[model samples]
Target chain A: TTQEDPHWATPLSSFQGFEMIKILNDHPKNKSVFVHGKFRGHEEEAVVILEKTPFSEETLPFALSGETKLKVGLKNDIYGNYHGTPPAQVNGIKVSVVYPATPKHLVKYSQQQTYLVQETGDDYRNITLPFLQAEAFRIQWVYNILEHKQESERIVFEDPDKETGFILLPDMKWDLKQVNDLYLIAIVHKHGIKSLRDLTAEHLPLLHNILKKGQEAIQEKFSIPPCKLRIYLHYQPSYYHLHVHFTHLNFDAPGTGVERAHLLSDVIEHLEIMPDYYSKKTLAFCLRENDQLLAEFRKAGRVPQKSE
Target chain B: TTQEDPHWATPLSSFQGFEMIKILNDHPKNKSVFVHGKFRGHEEEAVVILEKTPFSEETLPFALSGETKLKVGLKNDIYGNYHGTPPAQVNGIKVSVVYPATPKHLVKYSQQQTYLVQETGDDYRNITLPFLQAEAFRIQWVYNILEHKQESERIVFEDPDKETGFILLPDMKWDLKQVNDLYLIAIVHKHGIKSLRDLTAEHLPLLHNILKKGQEAIQEKFSIPPCKLRIYLHYQPSYYHLHVHFTHLNFDAPGTGVERAHLLSDVIEHLEIMPDYYSKKTLAFCLRENDQLLAEFRKAGRVPQKSE
Candidate 1:
């Protein structure tokens, strides 16, 4: 039965028809719980992704209203430990829900397809450099913000210095709650500087300023200290424009994994030690199965082409 | 109602008694398919960690018996794409199952407790250095292997050069299958190199040798190419012995995370640029809530201690 979209590996109606039989399997991560059941007289298993949906504009006002029913419980991390402030004993928790999940959520909750893509200095020269040059990633939104055309009002901190200055603001994905998954991004004011590859000892001041002031801004605004923040950058960034990510140490945000994440501290250290560190070093990272760079590598015969 | 052990949040019997009411939620990462179910009219959601129990000496023969039932199907990865070898379409897949899982299975399958423990050079000198020196980690098994006193039959590669020599062999956890999750370890012969901190430009020869020969040995024996193999080392490794790990890129075996995993290539590059790169750079890794290092950090006032 060929269908329009192949993503629905099993039919939606089949899942709706599944009758609960017994307890089969479950886990706490992303609240994934499984039940064994029967479907149309065949011993079958149905997958129901029980996710705490994100809050949207429509749901936010309603949820805050008195009309909606609410139950509050202290949320403990998977370790059965509460992350509490010492004096107040206040634990950090999350509570909210929205409807109709998306594919990113599914990808997020699913197992990561991360792999190590270690390459020599020459491999970078041959494969990655060419891929970056040929790729045309649309980052107009970034330009709009940088040019003060859009999202300008939301900027948390900005230094107008072209060389060592950057604009820091809360990432749009964050819910604007300082306590819940604090996320911020710092876009450098310097143009022509692209990804981690372009960074050298000359750019150490910019990196240092971003780290220090980014943390200070968040600290002054939200009371989160420097140590509690996890700051890093993504290689092969979503856009060619340079940016640094500042997230709470506890927030397992996207692009924070080893395959992509290069700590700002480490970057600074590397540059301080060797002015041409990034230029000379071999860079390694994972390319998703669907990544365009991977396709480029396949074309270059560096990575084997996908089989039929 | 606290029991003798607080780890079991809810009683085990309660989970067994849970009755499936409806098909509610589920996911497939760890196969956590859930049903909107009820237990004894109390409206309970039971968590059953369906895990493939490892094969022991007792269960191995029974599972392979002709009398037992068997089911075989083509396995597809999360992307709905075959991780097939070009021309062969023989995707790398796992087809073994066991029963009655353990507690670590629950923890492993649960959300990772990893956090970035980034510390500056001063922090390392003040806190981490003392911690490592003061702590006593038992590693008699490491010595037994190096001395050819135990498990010497499994040694896949060895070089007896005292300064740069090492032993490469299958990790004990690997089930002797060269295809499925091929895991190998290389333990350095030179003593006193406790962790990544001890590495310097002088040890570049050793690291380079490990990289070259370890990849060659696996390629020769298992037919796995260097590009397809993921190799790395943990900063705060499970043991104090200096060792390197070689794994199939397809295998998401434990400890491949950015918080802990540092590629040998990157390490070598860091050293090549700066002889004392590791010593001067700020290091960070996640410390689990229950980890002794975290406790030590708390005791030393580097991290705030837990509140009641």
Candidate 2:
């Protein structure tokens, strides 16, 4: 059955015979056990997630074992996840192994995600423009990748057209495992289009091409259909390169928050109606307290200086 | 100390002598057990949350109880929560019990959140406006409360200005226990203004008054400074009549997703810059698949007919 089916319970149970590789994460309060280990007799590591189920009506009543009873409260009892964390209504740590482990998986699973703010058009003109003029963000690595000097083998699809073509590859954040938490990036061959602000009616064709081909390629490789894909672009992206993110609708990938992510379909439609929509519109986003962009805004007195 | 302090681990522990009240939620996979009991000798209920702490670097390795080993894999290994899940990096569920939970608290913490889509101005014109014209939503209860026919004692703040004044009351979603997951709604004293669409430059005084007085009132009572609060409005709001939401910045309240939430600060600024901003601009929001609004969009041919 497809992993997207909400009722499908992950199948890799019984770690009794599994060979251990590395512990990705283990926690008690916000409890999770992520291990990069191989199921016994397997050649390489398989991506599996282990979680200690909550005490459900069926299982929790049997929880007392004569040992010294200890107590706890997770550092974060956060309950605001909009994605609707699954109904974890049922004990021992459950396990389900997926794909192979990669170095990228290590970093992706480890670090915390950054919270972003919306940067309005006023911000675009007043702060983002000046920040870009200063060329504060570096994209040498993007150029290197486009030129095939780096991560060349990772490309899943490539359209060599310099104007509308792009190289599709697994983002460093994707673990190259099964498709549920899938993430991939498509970088356009064109160099002048640095970010969302650089797009115009002239680049709509390029955007469409990425949207179409990126979705098509992922489906071709992973059997996920286009309708199931969530394609979008990031404004004030981590890098200056013009790239598109392709993720499964079920994945709930990061950086897709409304404050930062602009749906490619909405954007294409916007530019369709007004060719200069991006050029004239005010975009919004959050700037970190210590970010250079925030500093630029503060320097111009558009944002308040740090009182903290 | 203020509950907003992230450095603080929740204080109430040792359910040891606590009188059991009711089980709010209990789960093994999603791993959360929310109880609604009170401290043993206390007269009134004080909120507390209990979570089994994870096996920390200092703890986990000693987890061998050598009991009957059962295993699992939670139904959801969801990793892409946009709101960062704290570093759950380290075993038994820990426990934390916060303020006395109200019936509202039970409702608030029970059901899962709904994922929303950004509704553009076109949606407002084609689907939302038409839906509103049909008066598909119910809000007679609001009128009842306004007339002091119901829940009169719940009003936290009220200004009698028909055009500019409003009444602040705890949203049924707030437990009225503590300030952290605080949620409140302010309904305008005037009745004609239905939703965000009805506002024009003429209402800036009202908007400004709500922003100023609302902030002041909350600060006066809760000690949460303006910067510590998140004040906003929801498009396609559950009920209309132009209500504004006031929540603690740290609460991570639901319906605050970008697609649905509009910052009061941004709204005020937009109106300040252009009186007819709401009228001229297209606002976007998600319509549930089965929502009456979606039916309106499809009937108008503004959205595709569902094949499903």
Q: Best candidate, TM-score-wise?
A: 1
Q: Model 1: per-residue lDDT, tens digit, A22-54?
A: 332333343323333334454323323221222
Candidate 2 achieves a global lDDT of: 0.62
lDDT, residue A34, candidate 1: 30
- Over the stretch A168-237, how does candidate 2's per-residue lDDT look in tens digits? 9976545453454467899999987778887889988898899888878987997776645667788778
Tens digits of per-residue lDDT for model 1, B1-308: 35663333332211323443332222222222222223454432332322111223333223222222212111121111111111111111111111122444334444423335666667778887788878767788899999999989999999989899999999877987556589999999988888888899889999999999998998798887776677889877889989998887766677765667888888888788778878878777777667878876777776655531
Indicate the DockQ of the complex predicted as candidate 2.
0.12
- The CA lDDT at A188 in model 2 is 93
For model 1 chain B, the run of ten residues with the poorest summed lDDT: B83-92
TM-score of chain A of 1: 0.65
